[model samples]
Target: MGDKVISERLVGTSTVHGRTLEVHRLTWRDAPGLSYDVVDGATGELLTVDESFDEVPRLDQLCELLEAQQKIGTSSPRP
Candidate 1:
């Protein structure tokens, strides 16, 4: 996939992994869950697209997921 435009309506901003990120809330009409896009603060680059969240998570939980994304990005592939 390619870069996407950031949503005009953003839920909030979060600070994680020594970098600031923009958190956006996306709701699907067909499903009963909400998805989120964690984008870089400075650049509009997408850091991660966190979905499959059955329900809206608390700030701490969101933080954990974001951190996990970072860890996955940094870690080497294992056999």
Candidate 2:
């Protein structure tokens, strides 16, 4: 099934592992849940797309997810 975007907006910005990231909240029409997109603030590149929450999470919880993404992203070996 395809999911329709219900709402999407930038929640806030944070510096994780020395990289600036733009955190966005996204809701879907077909899916009754919340998702977050962590984007690279400088290059406008999408770094992480997490759709793991069944309900709205506290700001701290969101931060943890974003930080985890940052760690994962930064740990990858670059050519």
Candidate 3:
């Protein structure tokens, strides 16, 4: 099998309750893909996606997103 390529970009954001929400656009190489999780920086609460993307995402793509999020001052909540 060929190495699959995954990429992510910050698409937009939405406000929830009273927090600044960051949105990410994820793209995957093929079918039979993966899912993602969002975590709150302050309260350590995990947030689920309110909607689904047109394509299922990949693990690497999610990791890249997490990295980008960290650089932008957002991070996964403490587990």
Best by TM-score: 2
**TM-scores for the candidates:** 0.52, 0.57, 0.38
lDDT of 3 by residue, 6-61 (tens): 76555544444445444444455774553344544345543433333443334444
Ranking by TM-score: 2, 1, 3
* Stretches of model 2 off by over 4 angstroms after superposition: 49-79
Backbone clashes in model 3: 0
Better of 1 and 2 by TM-score: 2
- RMSD (Å) of each candidate, 1 decimal: 7.0, 5.3, 11.0
lDDT of 3 at 53: 40
Query: What is the clash tally of candidate 2?
Result: 0
Positional deviation of 36 in candidate 3, in angstroms?
8.7
In model 2, what are the clashing residue pairs, if there are any? Answer: none
Residue lDDT tens for model 2, 1-79: 1277778888777776566766777788887667766566777766544343443455566467657765786322211
Return the top candidate by lDDT: 2
lDDT of 1 by residue, 1-79 (tens): 2233333247787776676767666665555445665666776656555343444456686577667877786322211
